[model samples]
Target: MDSPTILLTNDDGIDSPGIRALANGLSDVGEVTVVAPADNKSAVGRATSSEARVHEHELGYALEGTPVDCVIAGIEALGPSPDVVVAGVNQGANLGMYVLGRSGTVSAAVEAAYFGVPAIATSLYLPGDRWKTVPKPEEYDEAVRATRYLIERGLDNGLFELADYLNVNAPAPENGRTEMRITRPSSVYDMTANHDGETVTLQDNIWQLMERDSYSEGERTDRQAIVEGVISVSPLAAPHSTEHHDALDDLAAEY
Candidate 1:
């Protein structure tokens, strides 16, 4: 049997240390090809450009497009489709339901899921004060460990049988070998907007709260797990969750 072929990508550009770490980590599992954005497309979600141009390089392809664009181009325009799609080891963590729609790293995995491909999306949670300072590739050991573990066990064991994709976030290395937890996205959102006569700015404080041990629920949630320095793995589906609503149907009859 042949080794699995893995397609790797990220919201950060191809040169990002996060993706590089991920690629190197997965090298032992299979042949890895990385196709990523030419520049940082963080928080762009699944946005794509119909007119975007692509540039080819020795390592992979770079697009003047979003993370979803890279996945589409990788499968449609690039060679031999991969066995699985993996995104990120992103510079910042992507947690909660509120962020799912706005995160390019998660969007890349979602795009793959829509195509019926099992996928993994990874991120590193950095402290707010140090988020501006880039970390070294060696620092990603835990994230890489979790990612490789998923790749090694997820496919062969049918871990993705019930999920369209996965969202994984690792605490900064200081938190030591974080325990793995199966979780659902937390339903919390924090947004602050400020206006000064002429200009307006939107700020999201969710990451700040995510870093604090006091604010998180001690249960096995992504936010809480990362705060405790453990790896968080969340199984996710592509479409919105559905629930039977016979009561709502009866209410509609009155109209």
Candidate 2:
């Protein structure tokens, strides 16, 4: 079906190397139009502006808002209705269930899902110390490669028919070639908050475990897959659901 039109964006801002790498790689698979945040809006999950200022840029357009705002603007104002929305090639990993709701990269894809458009979110998983220093643009090769692989392989196979979006993560390219694993967001939760005399400190202890190679999860979990130097591909849905509960049904009858 002729090359699809792709709407590319990121929470790291329009000028980030990650987005550039994505745009470049996806160009081989589709017509890529980038509309991303004007400045870093990382972790601003699904936030949007009712009205946003947009500026023309060499890459396409930049919105003065969050990643979700970029998608809204791209689909509604700045560019053609996209065949798919691709977010990130994010600087850091956005793995695990607890982190999804707070990740601008994942949220961009979620917004697209609600619009009835298939989407993909990509991120790079750096080892603990490597994360302290931002990697060079070339370092995003692994993420860009994995994204292209999915775009070419998944789009025509009814992959989106089964899932709203895909959450993809890759370890550094230096890890060498590794197999991609179809996985789920890890259920591990390690958040803790401490109150001091005049301050409160919140920490995600999962990072500590990840650093020590001690974090554990099922074989088909995103966190475990990435830690093992493999690409993680998680099929995700935007909606929330609950199993049938007789108690709730009875309560509804009373009401």
Candidate 3:
């Protein structure tokens, strides 16, 4: 059987070390075409561009746009139709339910899922605020290994039959390869907005909570799994979750 054709992209820009490491690792198992942002587009989830410039890259192509734009161009114009889309080996971990929609890495995978393609978003966990500094390419080995393991068997094993895509987070190589665990995105929310006399500063307090060992997410969540030194793979559907509430139902009926 032929190896899968992969659409590889990242928000860390075409020249980022994380994507380069991921591209090299994936080549061992598939034909990898990288269609990534020409500039770092981090935290810009699912944002698109009406038009983007394409550049020839050593691995594939670079786009002067968001990750979603890269996915579209790769599928529609710049490359072959892919059997799978792999985003990241992102420089920082994308964990928690609240954070997923804000991650360009995960957003790329979500865009692929909408295209009816299997996708996986991979990232390396860097504790605290240390994630602001990108890790060395060698530090991505654990994340690369986990993603490869999934892509090697996921399709044949009926993985995508059950889920649209996967969000994978792994500890850095200092912890070596750990066990893999199936997890859900945690519901923990700790965003805060502080208005100084002049400016409003937004902060994500979840990491601070973790540092204090006070986080409330249980063991089966992505955030906690990484805290315990294991790879977390959350099999997720592409659409935003919806739940019917009784109060809303009553209000509608009364109206």
Candidate 4:
């Protein structure tokens, strides 16, 4: 395809360094239009708004809505119909299977899949110690490089035929380089909640768990790949899977 148009978005807002890095990195390969949130909209999943406000940005547009809204707007009204949708260079990784529905980054890509547009969701893995600090745009280099490679070759390489989009997680570039690996969302989940007298505190301990090497599914899983400083690319479909069940059929018959 001739200079494929790329619709770029993210949960971290249009002005985020991660998205800027991605836009700059992918510019030569394709025309990148960034239609992202005006402010941080992280972890909003596939939420949509009947009316979302939009304004112009240097790269493209910034919408006062969720990531999914950006994808929809980009494809429908904002710019040329994109050849592919790219989300993130997210501040944090969207890894395990459980977090998929809660991640605006991945959800944007999923929304694109429903429209039959191939997408790629990319993120950087921040270790537990670095959660308090802001990452530089250059820190996203490895992730952006990986995303650029996929955008350049994915459409022509039969990758989209296999799945709707790809979920990629790259180790922070400062950690040095590692081989890219094809992987799956990890099955592990780590969430804890504490109830106080009048308050409930919820925490996602997956990053902490990772720091201690408390869990490992090895190379086959996204989290494990990031832990080992490897770039992970997992091809996945958008629609939820379904299967016939005799038990459900029998229950329906009795009802």
Candidate 5:
């Protein structure tokens, strides 16, 4: 293909600095058309709306819905279908297997996979106070660079043929260039509920582990890689699989 058409969307809203940096970084790589949420819709995984409203923007277009809505609108209601769907450069990292259904960033890529279009979902891993502070555009340099590199060089090399989509998480770059490592989502789960009177608060204790450097080491997992300041790239498939068991077969035979 001469110039690939890239469909860009995010849960952080169209005006977010992350998406803006992403669009600017990939501008030279292909024709990018933006169809993103009108306001921050973070963590609303794969949600769709029948009453979505679309409006033109200088960046491209804004959807009064979730990132998933943006993807469907871009593919069906907008103009031409895109060659690839790119999501995020998300405000926060989407790590661990448990987070897949809870992350709008990754969900956008998953939605694209159902349509048979290759996609990449990107995010930055910020620890502690960093999450509360808004990052400047320059802080996104590493993520933008890695994202462009993947689209321009990695995609054509059959990266998409094997995996339905990729979840890329990066830490802030150290000198100039950053290091990337292939990894799987860490199987860490730390959810709890605290009850006081009539109210209950849900919490994920993993944050405390992260703050304490208590996450198990070894760079084989996305959570580990992010903790070590490396970019984590996890190749993911879309299908929900089932395992064959002899007990099920025996039960079926009896029935």
Candidate 6:
């Protein structure tokens, strides 16, 4: 029997060490093809460029576009559609409902789910104070380990049987032995905007709180789970959350 084909991608560009680690880790399970942005796309979410370009490489294709574009192009124009799509091992963790619409890593997986493909989006959580200035690839071993474990076990074990996609976050290795936990996205949103002279800067303040020893009603959430040295897996779908309204039905009937 042939091994499963996996299409791998990330928001952090094709040359990023995170993707390289993921590719290497997944080598044992299947044939891997990496298609990702040529440059960092990070928080761009599902945005796509009409003038996007693609460059073929020995490992895979690099796109001058958003993470979503890479997945779409890989499925439609690249070689044989993969059995699953795996995005990231991103330098920073993508957690909470607030991040869902702004994370290119998760967006790539969400895009794949729309096509009925099982997908996994993985990221690493680093210490907030040092993350921006001291980011390093060596710190992602635990994240890669979690991602590899998922790919090896998730498919055959029916984890993705009912899930369209999964959003995974692993803590930095300094946190110690990591445990895997099924989790949900947190609802907390802490962001700010400041104007300095002529420019306005947007900052996500939640990271600071996330680095603290305590969290607010976030124990089982992705953010808290990562802080506790655990790999967080959040099963997600493409369906829009809905609510039934009898008032709307009555209004429609009166009309």
Which pairs clash inside model 1? 178-230
Residue 156 lDDT in candidate 1: 83
- Tens digits of lDDT, candidate 6, 1-255: 147789999998898888988888888878898889998999998898776888987568988999999999889887578888999888878989988989999999999999888899998877765546435667777777877777777778887887889999888778856788898999888889999999999988888886676655567888778778788999988776778899989999999
- Please give, for residues 1-255, the per-residue lDDT of candidate 2 as tens digits: 358889999999998889999998888799999999999999899777888888999999988999998888889888889989999889888999988999999999999999999999999987766765668988998788888877787788899999999999997667736689999999999899999999999988886687565766778999888878889999999997888999999999999
Give the CA lDDT, 0 to 100, for residue 136 in model 6.
Answer: 66
Q: What does candidate 3's lDDT look like per residue over 1-255, in tens digits? A: 259999999998999888899899989798889999998999999889899989898878989999999999999998899999999988888998887889999999999999999999998888867688878877888898899999998978899999999999997557534799999999888799999899999988887776555655689999888877889999999988689799989999999
Residue 243: error of model 1 in Å?
A: 2.1
**Candidate 4 residue pairs in backbone clash:** none
Candidate 5 lDDT over 1-255, as tens digits, reads: 557889999998999999999999888889999999999999898778888888999899999999999998898888478888999889878999998988999999999999999999999877765755667888889888888877887668898898999999988544223888989988889899999999999987876687565667567999888877888899999887878999999999999
Q: In model 6, which runs have C-alpha deviations exceeding 4 angstroms?
A: 133-137, 251-255
- State each model's CA lDDT, in order: 0.86, 0.88, 0.89, 0.90, 0.86, 0.84
Off by over 4 Å in 4: none
Per-residue error (Å), model 1, residue 111: 0.5
TM-score of each: 0.93, 0.95, 0.94, 0.96, 0.94, 0.92
| lDDT winner, 2 or 3 | 3
Ranking by lDDT: 4, 3, 2, 5, 1, 6
Write down the TM-score for model 2.
0.95
Residue 117 alpha-carbon offset, candidate 2, angstroms: 0.8
Relative to the true structure, candidate 5 has a C-alpha RMSD (angstroms) of 1.8
By TM-score, who's the top model here?
4
Using lDDT as the measure, which candidate wins?
4
True-vs-predicted CA distance for residue 230, candidate 2, Å: 0.5
Task: Give me candidate 4's TM-score against the actual structure.
Answer: 0.96
Clashing pairs in 6: none
